[model samples]
Target chain A: MTAKISPELPERLVAAALAALERGEDVGLRALARDTGVSAMAPYRHFRDKDALLAAVAMRGFADLRDQLLAANAAPDPREALVAQGQAYLAFARARPALFRLMFAGHDGGPPPIEDNAYGVMVRRVRELAPVSLEAATLACWSAVHGMATLALDGGLSPDGSSVEHAALKMIVAGISAAKRS
Target chain B: MTAKISPELPERLVAAALAALERGEDVGLRALARDTGVSAMAPYRHFRDKDALLAAVAMRGFADLRDQLLAANAAPDPREALVAQGQAYLAFARARPALFRLMFAGHDGGPPPIEDNAYGVMVRRVRELAPVSLEAATLACWSAVHGMATLALDGGLSPDGSSVEHAALKMIVAGISAAKRS
Candidate 1:
């Protein structure tokens, strides 16, 4: 009876992993367990190993990014939508550089195993916004926003410094809009 | 008899380090020496240790980036100049991701050590074009361009197996131009 009451172990495991990421875990099962205040052995029940746990965390991060993109895309104006998306992307990176690093950091298991992850949702968002071929539009939008966000996360662009990220993001929005218009 | 023909040993050592970086040697002086065709004992003659060698490599990357920016800024028109600068920046990243990584790998050494390197040149190029505060203009331009370069390097923006670096770069230039006009 006690074991059955724990219930929905996968979601709990994912949640615990994400919380660990937010708290600055280094994308390892050991760190995740440490961050979650759980026994390292506990994660094994839900995930096969460290790779499985990382995949789950990556999936969650992608979902979070996709949701943020969707919300921003639904904004009243196209320009505002783009700006909000850029800001949202940057905010996520700043709030979770550790996870952000894992999302792009080298993976030993070949091409990222991110199927059906946030990338698809992101592409869908781009498709909804621009009528161009999904390939061109996704590449265009992703490069612009991702590039802007990466710079912000690294020391290249500082929000607190005189060279604030807001101005750059505004230009990114304007640029995307102008490109679409042309 | 043996001291005859080599140019400045420091220059040769720095050149060896850069060459190692160019060949995509992963970080560490031993790997660099192997890539540079220098003896294992060679680097120590110029750099006090591996850290100093890495600093030289990073400094060189910045210097190269700065030179490219200056060349781009010298283009005839503002629009042309921006595009040129953007292209140059992207090209540098593509040509040297390993060195690029070393320059921003978050070492304990403060950025101030490398601030006067290529990054300074990039900031100065921005200062030359904008009427506003140099710090602000520099940040805006750096964020946009550096952001784009980073995404390109990380494969974050790849879609449909296409390289959209140039297209995204055009948007960045457009954004910077619009900001300047405003």
Candidate 2:
């Protein structure tokens, strides 16, 4: 057979893409292959094209998010866990704006179903918090959290530079509580 | 002399741009001029370039938003007015998504300042209700609203086909009340 087998080539390529994103440089397939210490063609074997490559990178983002939210969910204090999850969402965006954008970015072919992705983690957490199927309330809470992340990345949050996550969480808690009120 | 003194040229062009956006057609100065029934060069005189034109369009958007919020602010009941304003924000987004997107779209040159823009209107309304400079609270509220709108447009608000506004408003009310509690 071949000289040897390594960890999945696709996973390695996605990891390289993440590293490239962190470095604040362009992440073409060529660069990714080199970063992985593989031949330029190595990425092509795993990915159909740039779109496929980006899609793979987005999967990793979801996995990371799932891990963060699950850890947050484990917190003994329910309220603290909710806030923790919200904070983790913001932290992910701040730490890796490129990946965050890619995770949510619309594609020409439309986004893959979120049912089994990181979104599932969010849905499960929301259901646990809501208990009832107050879908609107859930949507509203999600919107608030998403908006803060977007505002921060787009410079919409005031530059007074206070704690963005704290502000965002307060709003989320309020939205959820208000939904329950009504 | 001009056949008739129409609304000012820039105003006419901005209107044309809005119309073009509604049709989901590409919006270039040339297309706008043609749609507005003006000479191709007419818009150029009023705008430095496409960016300038987009800035003008965004200004118009802010003006419209300001008017809507102002009317909401005049409601007899404070809480009712707050919900009314939030509803108006959603209605504006739903009715004019393209204009709304343009209002927030990133520009390489950086977006124009929000002095006396739709944001100022939001800040004024928020301050009137809060009576304190809890900037973080304000940001949280805004983020939530923005996120909901984005999710709805991007198809991330779940596929339940319920009243998005109802869900969104409940959360907003809760957030405001909670902020007051703190």
Candidate 3:
């Protein structure tokens, strides 16, 4: 749009968009371009439309989550590590509700499948435990945590309330045992 | 904005909006009003804004899901009924992906929590079965099923191709059994 304000226009666009999403603000290309201190039409050069820009933001979200998941492996015990992973997932969701929603809302084509993303790390963790029914264990653990993450965000869980870690620990243990039984 | 042509303009607006959403098209007030064959501003009278309209649609979604859950209770056995409920949940999501997403996506202040909505029905059903740990069982079954529904929508599950219904059934059955053990 003008003399390139920054060579990293694409990166800056997505970063600003992510910040907007995290702040519970709408992400529009024009708004993003302005936020990034770029020319009004600068975003259009990198992203086809608003949808494309949102997709890039979600991609960055998954990358952020991947790091968090990997970092959650701070325990020596596999079980503790598994539980930590669950907590990390929920914590990520709570900390960045809008961005987290964007990641799974299919808002921009459902965030692309990243090979080193959180889900991939989760599957590997489950396999290490060697449950009787890997499919059942994996789905059960993932779904249960995913559900709670969303539920927690909505404050939709029982009014009595419990921590995500406390709740996730119970479900993960139950789900893993269920697989073991199978 | 034209003079009211019909008394049911609000209902018609939501219906048209729901239709637009289910068809994988974006919902816009002006577009919805046009689609409903009403005045360009007719939707504004019923809903303060686009978010309000989306929230209303989500409310309708929960009500619809409640009915389906009840209908799924045709089975006499409680355990069978539980599995039936899980299947019904996924069926509802598959049949109405947009509304299903709307139900949980928290559109425009999110949908109001209905007393007789699907989640309430789910809690009641789970309590009736009397699981070992009500909270844990509820979270596990709900999360597992919720996970499967969203995962199936995104095709985010294991590539081996187990159907969402199949995976949900296993986790639900196992969850209930675990509760029974507790």
DockQ-based CAPRI category assigned to the predicted complex of candidate 3: acceptable
For A101-148, candidate 1 gives per-residue lDDT tens digits of: 666554434235233444564555455555544454455555555655
lDDT string for model 2 (B1-182, tens) is: 56446678888888888888888775998888887887788777878888889987877887787787777667765556666767677667777877776776654353643326556656655666565535765676677667766666666654455465665665665566556534
What is the TM-score of candidate 3?
A: 0.87
Candidate 3 wrongly placed segments (more than 4 Å): A5-7, A107-115, A130-132, A158-160, A180-182, B1-7, B108-115, B128-132, B158-165, B179-182
Candidate 3: Cα lDDT at B33: 80
Please list the C-alpha lDDT of all candidates, in the order they appear.
0.62, 0.68, 0.71
lDDT string, candidate 2, A1-182, tens digits? 44347879888888888988888776898888887878787678777788888977877787787787776667765456667777777777788888877776644354642424456556555665565535666666667777777777776655445465675586666556445433
Q: After superposition, how far is residue A51 of candidate 1 from its true place, in Å?
A: 6.6
Question: Once model 1 is optimally superposed onto the true structure by TM-score, how far is the C-alpha of residue A110 displaced, in angstroms?
Answer: 6.1
> Model 1, which residues run further than 4 Å from truth?
A1-21, A25-56, A108-141, A161-163, A180-182, B1-25, B28-56, B112-114, B120-140, B157-164, B180-182
Q: Output candidate 3 Cα RMSD.
A: 3.1
**Candidate 1's error at B9, in angstroms?**
11
In candidate 3, what are the lDDT values of residues A1-182, reduced to their tens digit?
Answer: 45665568899888888888878997887888788887788678777877777877788888888899899977877677877887788789888988887777675454543324677787777776645566667766777677777776766664345553465456555546555444
